[model samples]
Target: MNSKYQDFVPLKAIPFVEFLINEHNFTLKIVHQRETKHGDFRSLPNGKFQITVNNNLNKHQFLLTLIHEIAHHVTHQKFGKAKPHGKEWKTVFQHLMLPFLNPEMYPMEILPYLANYLKNPKASTDSDVKLSLALKGNIAAAGKNFIFAIPQGSLFIFKDIIYQRGAKRRTRYECLNLANKKAYLFHQNVEVASYQREYS
Candidate 1:
């Protein structure tokens, strides 16, 4: 463990590294050096990665940076390469980010900025609140009386919903994929769908 990150719980650190090694096949390296004018995590060509948490960084920021670097490692393994803050990196970064984030790490004051940069940080598995069809068309939904004027080929992000087993009166949602001109329907009060190529 780096002296700079002595406060981080070992249980949190070890499992995350193991997750990278086991799932993403990455080798983590901790190095000592003068602070560069750049980021704390870097990946080498040989699937080796370096994570540097400066002595001055606070606990939350350090953890965030560590996860961010790990995300880079995951992106490299998944896509062979990543564009700076592109879709692949953002997806992985957010995946790693949520596990450790708290009110301090993600305050309401910073939400708008983070949300814009994250570009849909709350994946389908993360939230129960789903945006409505009319909202995408610059209209709004009112108490189950929402209107839809969306055309075909529309893209949507369904939020995570909780469904009780054997419940007959299930929550249902239907919309169109404007881009593909296909109809999409989901039951909120049902088992979460398995990972299908459709979402990707």
Candidate 2:
């Protein structure tokens, strides 16, 4: 992992990069963008890939985009870009998302979303979880509001939620409010101050 990623996602970036190098034999390149974009592609294999991560995004978002793009790279290496989020891409997503689902290894910055998704990805989806949790007062705070119970990892969401998901869970969650809106969680907790507070 480079210093840039270290400055952003100090913990997961290295492990994620190692996963790419060892498991996929790929290198990571970070690029800052003018627009609020959280990682995109440039080239691949013979060409260099530019992960245009959203500088505005928090450490958790940055890490997620980085991992997501890396997963894309692996998918591209294994199967050239054909269909968006194709079978191979989905498979890679599954693999990457699986570990985060594990209790011992999950990062705190990504827990609420992961927990909701893992518990009932279809029912308790990220958005749904954020909504439910936010409604319950588990809101995300700026700066170091995130904390990892695991001393080594650098994220807050990993500590709070269990990663194990049960069968007969929803594969997707529906959030009417989330749709047609621009909202994202801060440290797995919803940012509600700016938006209307859904006081229960």
Candidate 3:
């Protein structure tokens, strides 16, 4: 776990996070990416606790996800069966994240957004577009562009589904899924595959 931590977390954050994992006796599993989530925590029937984080996340997101799951574990030990991202979890998550909000643990570019986010962190950091984009280093597949960067009426593919971009409704963009012809809201930072073609 010590060596694995080096690969997944920022250099300055390794020691503190290692302390939390060892103190809790958790089994941290770096698994393949799951589109719907960055990480999760669960208790085994055999009395073991495991936290799984996607292996593909960048170091900043990886550290955030690790602490996020650790907060879940700590919350469970204290609150027992509470709402997954309810007040209890939020409080625990905020407290656990406070220490890592520093320049040493995070980059200057990401720190401000992170500090503001931890004030009332959501179930996913992707909820904050500025923060999410910063975590991504504003980089995507060379030719791909963020959903927001494309014009309305343009076509884009996400998760293999083709969506036609629509108007901005408050924080998210409204998009029509070409397959089902149903509307779905997309985060501005969502990177959609770009290509040129004619579609009816």
Which is the leading candidate under lDDT?
A: 3
lDDT of 1 by residue, 1-200 (tens): 45323564233454554555467555444444333311355676875666554443333334445566667667777897677457897888877766544444454444344445345543221122232121122223221212122222333333332211221234544544444556555444212321122355
Model 2 stretches astray by more than 4 angstroms: 1-4, 10-13, 21-27, 33-36, 44-46, 102-109, 115-200
| Error of model 1, residue 43, in angstroms | 3.9
Q: Provide the clash count, candidate 3.
A: 0
- What lDDT tens digits, residue by residue, belong to model 2 across residues 85-123? 566766676677665444343455456555554343331
Candidate 3's TM-score reads 0.93
Weakest ten-residue segment in model 1 by summed lDDT: 126-135
What is the C-alpha local distance difference test score of candidate 2? 0.46
lDDT of each: 0.45, 0.46, 0.90
- Ranked by TM-score from best down, the candidates are 3, 2, 1
C-alpha RMSD for every candidate: 16.1, 11.9, 2.3
The digit string of per-residue lDDT tens for model 3 on 13-126 reads: 888888999998989999999989999999999999999999999899999999999999999999999999899999999988878988998999999999888888899998
Per-candidate TM equals 0.41, 0.49, 0.93
**Candidate 1 wrong stretches, greater than 4 Å:** 1-38, 45-47, 103-200
